[model samples]
Target: MTTAPKVALVTGATQGLGLALVEGLARRLAPDDTVYLTGRDAGRVAEAVRAVPGGGARVRGELLDVADPEAAALLAGRLEERHGGVDIVFNNAVMRVGPDDDPREIIDGYAEVNNFGTTRVLRAFGPLLRDGGRLIVVASSLGTLHHLAPVLHDRFDGLASLDEVDEQTAAWRDAVKDGTARSGAWPGFVNIPSKIAQVAAVRALAERRRERDAARGVLLAAVCPGMLNTPTSALWWDVGDAATPAQGAVPLLDLALGPVDPDHYGQLVRHGKVVPWRP
Candidate 1:
């Protein structure tokens, strides 16, 4: 008997780590399998499809802006009709805006792209994930644990469940609105809060799967591919030699097609192992 093809979705696949993911995902695909490469621009996404290894025949292009929930829902709808359901949903879209004078705008902007957008994509495509499927969130572990205020540290690290996560998002919004976000030690960059939020969100989602729907082994994880030396990242990362984009894609590719370790679900992976997660 022949096994059916799998449907994999990778957001922001026009360049950088997202582009690299499509290439790695392609290696794992059988001839009939489909990997959807999505980005904000139709032309870039279409061009990116062909840039994949193996001539990108099995790769399909879709356009999406991570913040647009309607676009995400529409894509998920089309995927369901085309393939019955999707096997993997890779939430890799990202944004790093400046620390403007009005920190609230900066915070809201980052949350919209990195935190809110990630959750929206997951919520839209999650139901479509077949049993034993994977939900991968591309995150940075740099400030996930140790970079928040003393009061906020505990909540960030011990985010017990998804309900608490919603509460946390609300609190963040309040902080941004009240003009106390920076004074609260929320960090100078949006990447800090954005990544922390990513980890918390995935952990909460995994907890839900464990509690309410254990029958379907849909694994969720936030993976930090380390600081990669991609064109966009190299300009700011003059501190040290970083992994090439291909090197960064290893953990994501492995987890996307793995033995399905439940422990890894909701966990943050780094350097190919699930570290202490302390920060």
Candidate 2:
């Protein structure tokens, strides 16, 4: 008997790791399977689809801004109507700011796009994930709980729901804006809190929807692709001999399409291994 066609969705696929994910999926999936690559810019989305390895009719492009819930919902609806449901979903959209940028703006920007935006995408696309599907959130290594103070560890480690995660992230942002972040024992770096929130969201979501996910065998994981030689990495640190975007995408591709490990769900994984959340 012939296997059914699979459907995949990858956010922020116009460039870098996201782009590589689209390419990897395109090459790995059967030709009849559909791989949807999304980006905010229509032009870039079209270009990325065209640039995928062995580009074919199976590769499709769509315009999506993860920060926009309406757009995500609409896209999910289209996928449901067209393909019945999605087999794989990769949340790869992100935003970063330089040190010189305003702390409040940086915090809010990251929170909106990287933290809450991740949750929004999950909420919209999660229900559409077919049985035995995978949902991978592209987080950063800096998003670990150990990066924060011990006092803050339980707050994140104990996240049981998305609402709680939101409250924690909001509290961190408020502390920063009110000049109490340092005293509150939260990390001073603007990106750390948001990244922490992103990972925490994944953990919380898994906990909140454990029963439903278990029945469907849907896997949820937060992944750190590690530092890559992308433009975003170059702007923040010296990436001498860093893994290329394609190389960094290896683990991500594996997680997206490889064997499902029940232990990996709701945890942060790197290089095909689970990374400790706490120090």
Candidate 3:
């Protein structure tokens, strides 16, 4: 009997790192395999699927906003019914902070999609993950504990549950709004905490689902794709010579399809290796 084809899905894949992931998957997966790329905009999703390498014959696009639990659930049901289950899931959806954006606004609103949205996707599609499947979250090196003060390290390291991470995130956001964030030694950059929460969620989920994931041979991980010359990066810094999205997708693709190393699960990875959360 012929081996079954793998089914992979990517969120927020209309452009940037997410888009790069679809392109890379198109190249790596067998021609018979299917790759699903989703974004909130149907037109962009269609356009992105059309532009994939090899004319995107094996790729499909869907309208999915990670923040919309209903849409996520519907898509999960559809994938389960049509493909049996998904073999790889790349959670790449993120609402980036703009140069002039309000700090409090980034925390309150963006977190809905950036931090919590990821958790939404996980809960929705996690059960449908096939045996030996991989779930990868595209986080950032800026989210690492090394960027935060030593006083805050223990708190983040000790986060054992999703609720704990959420509570900590809420407190951080409140601090920023009240001008006590700096006094509390939180990083000045708003994106840092958001990314930190994103990464922490991965660890918390991995710990909570350790037995289930182990029995099903599922792998969960978060990764920093590195600085890339994308519109999101352009919002904060000069693009000059920064790695392109295609280049940045390398590490992400590795985590998505590389050999399973339990040690790397729940860790933030970059350049094909686990990045230490602290010095």
Candidate 4:
């Protein structure tokens, strides 16, 4: 008999890198496989499911807003009841930082959705990832250690637990509010610091994942898809005619459906390969 088909899920799948990722995954899905596409807007989710390549038959829509902790739990329960568990989860839902939004709004919004929101999603789905599964956090190269002081770089590399990760991000937000973030090397931008927190969360979760469940084959990692020119890019920052989201989606998709290797677990991938995150 043939094996059961895999199940995948993508958050913030309406447009941009999220949408690109959905399309890329759709093209590779086995006929028996199903990939869930989710976002806060039901209409957009439905529309996205239909618009993605090969999505009509294989993609399922779920109304989910990652910022809401309850939403993750609710969706997790449904997945447990419906599909038993999921094989891949891509956490890409993020709150964009407007050009003129207050530092407080920028910092707090990023923490709530990008950091804590990702935290909730990971916790909610941690138990539901099948053996030999993967959880990929879509991050940005701007979050890398190249911008941080060596001390801070080591600190991120050595995050011991989730609580510490939470505390660390909170401190950065506080620094922004106090007008010291610039000097502190955080610089008060939503994308970089938020992605930093996401990377830390991946490491934090990877450390204790097996203790909670014995399957022990889930790979938790973060990735910084190179700057891409998408509809959403101009709203945040301008990369003059940069790589398309389709080009960016390749690395994220590779981690989802590539040769299984334990060495890739808990590392930050760039362009489909694990790279030195600390440098």
Candidate 5:
């Protein structure tokens, strides 16, 4: 008897690292496996599905703006109805546009789509993940403590506790209501906030999974695909001399199809190595 193929869903697969991930996984996995390639642009998603090097028949496209609650819900419903459960869920979409009419407005827009949109996707589809399923969040090193602490110190008066950070975030929202929110303080890049938020969310999910069952066998981990020569980092793409999209796909693919280790759950893997995020 033939075993059923694994089902994988990758968001923001239309271009850049995300597209490379879809292609890499499609080439690696069996032809019977299924890959749900999602992008906010329908045409782009379709194009990505067709662009996979091998097992094109196993790839399918879906127009999903992950930040949209209705869209996430619809995608979750469709997955549940068709696949029963998803074996892997890859969160890779992000928005980094800046120099808005107002800086605060730009920050809010980035948080809405990058942070909140990712949360929505996790919440919507997390339950449909199989017992041993894997959740791969494509994060960035910029969000790591080593990087964020210095940036936070430069921006704020002092190092704030997580609660204090939440309070500040809330205060920013309140200030926005009164039209007093400051924009100069918001980080311009898309990776920083989104990666930080994704790391926190993935850790929380891992904890919840453990509490649900120590033997549940599910794995959730965030990965920094490294600075690739993608559009997302086009402005600074020349700064450090980035790697190719194929090179960037190595770590992501390892997280998806490689060995399973409970100890590695909730950790951040980068450049083919596992890095400690917290002391």
Candidate 6:
């Protein structure tokens, strides 16, 4: 008997890790399988879709700026209309405004793109995921609370659960709203706090995925691909032995195809190690 082709939707596929993921999945999936390669630029999306390993009609490109809630919903609607449902949803797009940008703007942008964007994608495609379908969130070790102590100067290592992070975010949000949020602290930018908030949001999504049984038994996982020498990281001073985009795609592919297990669900996997995350 022939198996049904799995449908995958990858955002930010114009280049870097997202592009590599589209290519990897294109090579692994059957001809009938559909892969939606998306990016902020239409031309870039088209180019990335065309650059996939195989020259087949199976791969298609779409213009998607995940930060735009309406655009995300529209993409989902299009997918639903065309394929009825999708088997995999990859939330791979992220925004890192340069160091020179206004700190508040940077934080707001990251919060919109990294945190709300993932939530929008999940909300849009949740109904489209097939039973036992997979949802992969391409995160970074920087977002891992466990790694925060060692990586982020031991500032807030005590944040272990989504609730704790939520409380922290709420406090910051309140501070900002009340005109008390600091603007002169170390890493004195809203971006850092936003990153922490994004991680917390990811954890909350995982928890919700685990609790909901009607959503095709979705297995949500956040993956940290390590520091990749992609164009996105060029602005950073020290990327630290950045790996090729192909290398960064490994964990994503593994998470996409791995067996469904509760232990793996909502977990953050990086460097072949399953970093702890809320269930």
Q: 50, model 6: CA deviation in Å? A: 2.0
The pairs that clash in candidate 1 are none
* Pairs in clash, predicted candidate 2: none
Count clashing residue pairs per candidate.
Answer: 0, 0, 0, 0, 0, 0
Model 2 CA lDDT for position 154: 78
Deviation from native of the Cα of residue 81 in model 4, angstroms: 0.6
Best by TM-score: 2
Among all windows of 10 consecutive residues in model 5, the one with the lowest summed lDDT is 153-162
Q: Any idea how many clashes model 4 has?
A: 0
Which is the better candidate, 4 or 6, if ranked by lDDT? 4
- Assess the local accuracy of residue 180 in candidate 6 as a C-alpha lDDT between 0 and 100: 59
What do the candidate models score in CA lDDT, each in turn?
A: 0.77, 0.84, 0.84, 0.78, 0.70, 0.70
Put down candidate 1 lDDT per residue, 1-279, tens digits, no spaces. 976689898998898888888888888778788999999998899899878878432888998887785878888898899999998888999875532445566666667778778878877887788887888889877646766666667666667665576577768767876868767677656577667878888877776676543567777788888888865665566625888777789878888888777667678887567845564
lDDT of 4 at 97: 72
Q: What digit string (tens of lDDT, one per residue) describes model 5 on residues 111-150?
A: 6677666777877778887877888888877655554544
**Considering summed lDDT, which 10 consecutive residues are worst modelled in model 6?**
147-156
lDDT of model 5, residue 113: 70
Among all windows of 10 consecutive residues in model 2, the one with the lowest summed lDDT is: 49-58
Candidate 3 Cα misplacement greater than 4 A, ranges: 55-57
For candidate 1, the lDDT comes to 0.77
Which ten residues in a row are the worst by lDDT in model 3?
102-111
Q: Write the per-residue lDDT of candidate 2 for residues 1-279, one digit (tens) a residue.
A: 976699998998899988888888888888899988998899899888878878432889999987775888899998899988899999998876776777765676667777777888888888888888998999888889778888778777877888888888878877777778866677777788788888888988888777788777889999999889976678778998899988988888888787788889888998888888878
Q: List candidate 6 segments past 4 Å from native.
A: 55-57, 146-180, 183-191, 211-217, 237-240, 277-279
TM-score of 3: 0.91
Give candidates' CA RMSD values in order: 2.6, 1.9, 2.1, 2.6, 4.4, 4.5
Which candidate should be chosen as best, given lDDT against the real structure? 3
Candidate 2 segments exceeding 4 Å error: 55-57
